[model samples]
Target: MTYDPTFDQTRLDQLADQCLADNTGTGKVIFLSDDEDNRLELTSWRFEDEEAKARLMKSDFKLYLLELLDTLLVYRAQHKQPNASRGVVSVCKNQMTVQWVSRAEAERLRDL
Candidate 1:
């Protein structure tokens, strides 16, 4: 996934919380602004505790993260386009990373 390191943590993290559907939710991925070269920017979500990882990993955390991220993205996309929260997002019990891009950016990623 491609990304920029300059994203606003507050907003990106808001998207992360939005990704989780629950305030207690931890891991997430969200879109950010594009670079001057037009590449998609990215960010990853993470939990703060080892116990949290242990609990989340007990199940298919990756699958759950993907499902949750997709749900959040589609939900947001309905209201926003272009930088419509599309891109590559990954999660483990420990970390989640998402590339921020347009719908076309996600499409290009799929083609890869």
Candidate 2:
């Protein structure tokens, strides 16, 4: 068997709810429009508990997911073929690959 990362669906739903708390079911990750080569852009996403997001990001599972996502992001950034879209990402309790799907799709998963 191989090692894989997994995320909790309920936690994700809660996170998304928190992020949209003030904005009414909307969130944004802004990309700067400046030419400063090394300047980092500011971004924001609402989460109920800051620690929760921080903990998730700092987890070993997240580290693994980021590694996987990095490859995909790099490919997408290089090609610029497909437009980026908003969605949710989830992982099964006993699965390897992460599942990236739309909000409706996620709702279906949650219902199941």
Q: Which candidate is the best by TM-score?
A: 1
Best-matching candidate per lDDT: 1
Query: Model 2 segments beyond 4 Å from truth?
Result: 1-59, 85-87, 96-112
lDDT of each prediction vs. the true structure?
0.46, 0.35
lDDT of 1 by residue, 1-112 (tens): 3342333333335444544342333543443333443333443434455565455546454355545555545544444434545555544323345555666755555554
For every candidate in turn, the CA RMSD to the true structure comes to: 10.7, 12.2
Question: Which whole-number lDDT from 0 to 100 does residue 67 have in model 2?
Answer: 40
Candidate 2, residues 1-112: lDDT per residue as tens digits?
3212223343344443433233312211221112222122222233345554465445554444434344433433344423222123432222222233443543454444
In angstroms, how far off is 44's CA in candidate 2? 10
Ten-residue stretch with the least lDDT total in model 2 = 24-33
